[model samples]
Target: MKKIEIFSHNPVLLKECVEGLEIKPEGTYVDATVGGAGHSIEIARKLESGKLFAFDRDPDAVLVSKKRLSSYPAFVINSNFCEMKKRLESRGIREVDGILIDLGVSSYQLDNPKRGFSYRHDGALDMRMSKQGVTAAEIVNKFSEEELIEILKKYGQERFARSIAANIVKRRSQKLIQTTLDLANIIKFSIPAKFRRNKNPCKKSFQAIRIAVNGELESLEIGLEASFDLLKAGGRLLVITFHSLEDRLVKQKYKIWSRGCVCPPKSPICVCGNVPLAKLVNKKAIRPSDLEIATNPRSKSAKLRILEKL
Candidate 1:
């Protein structure tokens, strides 16, 4: 197994995340997204007789994680967390004391041009987290303009989705969009020069394409369900989301799970007798400290939320 640079991953919210888990020495835990085993390693060390099931869709990550977590009672699986329930069941693990899902792309992936995950360096336009589905090049070169627009708008929330999609279609027709820089250039020129001041012009489009290729949002929805269901009574769920879309999804879902009465507002009586399945550990989402963000800028956008099963 190939090992990654241990220094690559700074483990966003490391202190808050571990403390939020309220780890018991013998309690089982799950690290649903083992980007570089940063969070997984800590979770595993807290366990004595307890087990830690760490998963990642990226084979490279799985390889690196297994090596990093070898010293602890951790099982690194080469699968998406969406399959958490079935995988855990296969391993005879029905419930866990806590689960942590960090929905951020690994720094190693962004830094390695060979993986085709970064626009900063030239590489192929492939962005499959699992390396098992449609590649970004295929989407950019073959997808309809309308399809591209929809993905950019919904996933990336790109303000210039239409212009970007139109540009991709036009550029691809002249010659196939093969590399990250090729698509990045198209995105840069598509947006108005005035609007492209602070942030990288390609950031949103690149993120949208990657999300589409990996089915990331869909996977997160399913993974959240599986993770919540796999928790034992009073077991906590700690989710660290890196963007507004992801953070919103977790916030909305957590709100639903923490709400008590299901009765309609107009209908005063409480007839359904529906009770909350969980309680929010923190009313507001937790953000990284200025100190942490100053050190690891990638963590600036991170938001951590915790919910305990009721």
Candidate 2:
């Protein structure tokens, strides 16, 4: 096993995430997606008697975080953050003061060709965050054309989902799509020449396949709820999402939590008795500073949304 060295990863909106948490020196905190311990280290540093629970499905990330956070009062867990509630319960932790979730693929993963996350890479089609369960190759080869289309359209919001799906099926009929470049080429050719020139046609298709393989969105949905439920009253949940899809989910959930009424607009009385559970820390999502974007281009799409339990 190749030990992953602690490579530098610029945590997107680091200041915003930390400030949103409003860290109390003696309050418990959780870094749900502690990729490379970028945000975890900062949270750990601010703790006096408090503890930080860092969770990551990727074993490599867990190893890196464990080392990076060794100096602080942090517990590194090699499990999906969706299971955070149960895991924390096992440790006799019912609620935490704050939670931070950075829902972006780490630069380490993308830069490593063997991980097969980037469309720019030409490695095996294995985009598993945990390095376990179904690989991207299995989904690419076994899923039906319609299934592929649905994943691409729903997850990636790809306009050329139908064409991409058809091409994938057609190509797999002749030869198995075994590598990242293989599928990237198929996706590139599936779209028109003009579109290809505008942007990488494989971007959306690769993203869709990676999401499906890893169940990224499903896990995020579950993790968000778990994190919210585990937060003490007045506790904050700060999430940094990389794409519009993830941001939309976070925004809608925050809106629902911050709203007090469920009754229709025509209702004269509050029959449902639904009270607001949380309030948004910021009315709008926070974006990276221009300097940060220029220095780290990957942070360009990042958006941070925060909510505090009421």
Candidate 3:
């Protein structure tokens, strides 16, 4: 029973996520988003004859996870979790005992100025998790005001979406909003000063832009289905989301999967034949404890949900 202790970042909902998996020492597992390898190392350490496959979109995370899980039987893949099924099939793996997805940007990305994920940091407005594709800057500058409003409202749940979108368009028309702070300042001014109290007013806008740049929601939608299809009977799927939007998507998807029949109110003959594919392990989403939030403020918004294949 050796330990893996080569990580600097504290993974959100660590205890809850690991416990939710209900690891079988000899069962195969996958860490769908092995950011910083904090969760990977723990899962790998628990494995005996079982194998661990860790995946991350960011090459940096892939490298870190590989190093951390080196002592254990783990393979780190430099790809998004949405490709889990294809990548696993390529490795001749058809079914897995458990799959864990820890969503949202890692602390490394948020702390690094080069990644442009943090509202606190002043850097290029590039928020691509894979460091590829359209940047947050491009979304802010090139996207129409309506497009900006939609993303801010949908992804960020921002109340000042219209004002912020208008301001972004106005600012970009005058000057190409180049940096993260450049956009942050625009967002801050757009929102009323009274609404901007102790908390940062730019957080929502930053999240919306980052999500748009990364295509996170779409990936999650696909990844969940792929993961469930790859799960063996009684196998578990655990997801830790950092925002309400991601959590809502996960919740609704899980609810759909857990449903047994689609018949109307009066007619009950099991005509649809929709047997439940999975059952919710926890009736409600698991949230981090108060102590956990005290220790890691970044985890305050995290919600963990577990579902087992039926």
What TM-scores do the predictions have? 0.96, 0.97, 0.95
Tell me the spans in candidate 3 whose CA falls farther than 4 Å from its real position: 1-7
- Model 2 — TM-score against the truth? 0.97
Greater lDDT among 1 and 2 belongs to 2
The global C-alpha lDDT for each of the candidates, from Candidate 1 onward, is 0.90, 0.91, 0.90
lDDT at residue 299 of model 1 (Cα atoms): 91
Q: Output the TM-score of candidate 1.
A: 0.96
Candidate 2's displacement at residue 302, Å, is: 0.9
| Residue-by-residue lDDT tens digits, candidate 2, 79-148 | 9999999999999999999999999689988878789998897899899999999999999999998999
lDDT of 3 at 152: 96
Clashing pairs in 2: none
> In candidate 2, how many Å is residue 133 off?
0.8
lDDT of 2: 0.91
